[model samples]
Target chain A: MTERAVCVIGTGLIGGSLMRAAEKAGRAVWGTSASEDTAAEARADGFDVTTDTDDALRRAADADALVVLAVPLPVLPEVLRRVDAVAPEVRLTDAVSVKVAVADAVARYAPRARYVGGHPMAGTSESGWSAGLAELFVDAAWVVAADDGLDLDVWRDVAELAWACGARVVPAAADEHDLAVARVSHLPHLLAAVLAAVGAGGDDALPLALAAGSFADGTRVAGTRPELVLAMCEGNRDALLGAVDDALGRLGAMRGALASTGGLTATVFAGHAGRERWAASRDPKGVKVSLKGRAPLAALRAVGRRGAVVSGWKA
Target chain B: MTERAVCVIGTGLIGGSLMRAAEKAGRAVWGTSASEDTAAEARADGFDVTTDTDDALRRAADADALVVLAVPLPVLPEVLRRVDAVAPEVRLTDAVSVKVAVADAVARYAPRARYVGGHPMAGTSESGWSAGLAELFVDAAWVVAADDGLDLDVWRDVAELAWACGARVVPAAADEHDLAVARVSHLPHLLAAVLAAVGAGGDDALPLALAAGSFADGTRVAGTRPELVLAMCEGNRDALLGAVDDALGRLGAMRGALASTGGLTATVFAGHAGRERWAASRDPKGVKVSLKGRAPLAALRAVGRRGAVVSGWKA
Candidate 1:
């Protein structure tokens, strides 16, 4: 069998990191950099880098295994057009956060794009080539959204990439993927940023100095790439907006219950149990972890005893 | 002057920790335990412990400093009654999370209690005598809320104790303190718990194993003593609710902005800067520190640079 060629478009954090790791796994890797600077950096990091997006398409066409669109949402439509003109016979896919927008774009730009929509829910506050790491996507979720009757072989290859990068592959449709992120991904960032702004609002700003790690951790996502998040929110606005409203309602009810005797009291225990379960579980890649609360770090092994499906904890 | 005798009520995480820290700081420490077992354990940990709240109050009545009502919100009234009847002359205070409730409870039950409301805003997920650590309160905030005309000496003593634990001191009205916490402290726990529950609710339930450090850090406070958190939420229900509403509204705005081209992009940057600062600033606290988006493992000089008060460098 000819060597499996994997072309990754947009060599920033996610793309660059996966390319480095893919090269290590012995895959023939090709990447397109929108700028000469990025192309130089990607080449310096030991991968074939191209400035012409079509060269990437040709290299990834008919003879290859996977073509990953790892660009931002705003540029996806243009890239999809280029891929269509060149790689119509190839197994194609994307690493965009908003699957619905990208999927729609693919339909309009390249109806037979042979592409699947996906989001690797992993990143740091850093960006650019420097943010790339061999284990960047390890143990995170790589949500794969494909239509009916898609090629099973392509799915297998993409899933392998997910597995190789230590990410768990979860299957969802475009809208389903959109909603899940609104809840788990996008909402958290918004809360953190606003609270920080509020905390920083007072005279003397001393209250902020006392804000501590809990404040930072809870608001960690707020500091994510603004352009990226803004793009995501735009692409998945209604679902994300609904989640915000739903969360607010819950927060309001939490307050109402706190005022009543039998109220917030009942909910507190449920929160405790939920947190316990959250802490006991490992990352999707199966690494042991401790959430903010201490779950008797000694008894974490008992998580499996509690019927936790921890992946690497298989005794 | 002779060493001022101080009685620390409750022999759990906060109380026991205070007692140990106080003893090390040269205060004559007397501890009140909720039960005989805890009292015995407190004694074993080298503090003077008593099972009778009234008798201990009577015996320690002549003392200068009194840490009162070593109980959650529900039992505070009774503890105040005992303190009023037995130690009426001593300067009194508490280590509760919600300040207004403690102030109100003391005012209602022990009007002459000479009480100033306090919250150390420092702790770990551990409880009991075994969890006692003299260094726990170091460099944390020892917030004091007292009437303007109240004896500065009294507030000074409490501040001294907080400082002895290596904490910085902040002053506010009891009501203001509660509102501040409701916004920064209480709301985060609820939000984290909400997120945790959402993660826990998935069909495969593998989100638990997929729960990473971020999930753990974010949800850690939710797993805090449910009764304790319930007390805080219950005590400051209105403010906490307001905070929740505000948080949700902001989160919604952020989601909307993420989905659109405009909305609080600078706020997000400021938040990230503020959070990074909080994790990096130094207030010389011995409190267990955590961060949302960053690690709190920098040198002691860099412990808490997250607030707006500290200047942020735009990245």
Candidate 2:
């Protein structure tokens, strides 16, 4: 099978990295950035990058390339409008942090696009084209939305792209993806922000000075660009609100236990168990699903539900 | 002056590391552990480790060595009683995580001892002597309680001990240190526990599979031994309660904004600013304090309040 050419929109860290990874995987790849300076930088680096989103889409449409939307959440609508105008029937996916939001926006603005939402669970705190790396997605879990009635053809295209970039595919419904990420990703980001603020908000700088590894690790994500964090966090507000509520409930229970009984056995043990569960889930045994098999979507979702990842497709 | 001999009363990670660091710094160091197995292991490693706390304290008294209480919070009272019986007047200090609790315990159990509370702000999740590294305290902050009326002679001994362990001195009042660590250390531990439990508490394991660096870092401290976490967090209940309340307030406000205005602008910006402040405070300009000067305690406290670390003492 001929590899699908990848046309990545918004040549920032994620998009630029995807373009590089796809190219390195022997797929023809090009990208466009909203920032002319970013496009110029990528072009100067010998990548086929441009500021003309419409032109890139036109070429992608002509070549039947896989189009990956890599813009931040706040600009999804504007980018979707352009996708709608230039390549409404293109094979489309996204690298946006939030899936349901992007799915809804695509339904509203680019209804004809064969869109399969995706989020590669990978990145550094750093951003911009300069921080792009071909290996960013290596060994990362890349979520491809397996919502009902999705285009299997486009889904395969996106999955192939992820696999080509050395990521394992974890098929999940768009809503499920949103909720899961809210717990693991979005909530952590918010908590980090709060932790950072609390650590620095003290009258004396003693807290900041005395902060060691826990403080550094717990608040690491707070160093991410505020605008980017705001976009992703606020975009998944509903799911994140639920996650935040769950965390607050736990915190309240913890405080009450500490105040009354002077014991954190429940909280600490529960957390340790949780961390153990996570550790056990790492480097999970690889599972394969034939895309042409009966109930491929069901199989994929079942694998994901069991915390298993599709390392690759089976013949 | 000749280096004071060191007697560490608990040969676990921090205590064992301190013994190694002190010995490496040319101080005569010996240690005791509540666990005979650990003591035996240290003894096998060619260190002077014993399971007899009273014997260790008696020897420390004979040599007029620094008595470093390296036991957990729960066992501190018992250890202090031994100190009262065997070495009540020895130059004393502690390596407890919570200073106020240790100080209060020392006052209650060994009131005649010239005690100076201290905490080396460094550790790993692993415990026992096997995990101890001689370089563990190198470049780490060793906080010595600078509360008023402290024995200047013992204070110098503790400060010099910290320096001998290749750590910089951070002078803070017991109450101030408790509050500061409540915000920076204990609170992060609690938050990490909550985060780990929440991430693992999901009905499906998809969240765990999708977990990335943010989730990993946020919950890293949750992997620490539960007993240790419980002892430190519960030992400093009053201050930790305040920190937990502060975190809950920030989380509540963040949720409210996300739900109402769909904007995390304020929270994100505040967190970003906090992280930036922390980054700015790293590798701060070295400052010196004269241990023999007038109002040295006041000078140390002033330096600590300004987030300046005492890298060394002036003659």
Query: In model 1, where do residues sit more than 4 Å from their true spots?
Result: A1-3, A201-206, A255-262, A266-270, A273-315, B1-3, B62-69, B198-217, B248-315
* Distance from true location, Cα of A108 in model 1, Å: 2.0
Residue pairs with colliding backbones in model 2 are none
**Fraction of true contacts reproduced, model 1?**
0.41
Global CA lDDT computed for model 1: 0.67
**lDDT of each residue in B101-120, candidate 2, tens digit only:** 88888899999999999999
Question: Each candidate: fraction of true contacts kept?
Answer: 0.41, 0.89
lDDT values, one for every candidate: 0.67, 0.91
Residues A84-160 of candidate 2: C-alpha lDDT, one tens digit per residue: 99999999999999898899999999999999999999999889999999999999999999987788899889989
Evaluate residue B284 in candidate 2 and report its C-alpha lDDT on the 0 to 100 scale.
Answer: 57
TM-score per model over all chains: 0.83, 0.97
CAPRI accuracy category, model 2: high
Flag regions of model 2 displaced more than 4 Å. A293-295, B291-294
Q: After superposition, how far is residue A164 of candidate 1 from its true place, in Å?
A: 2.2
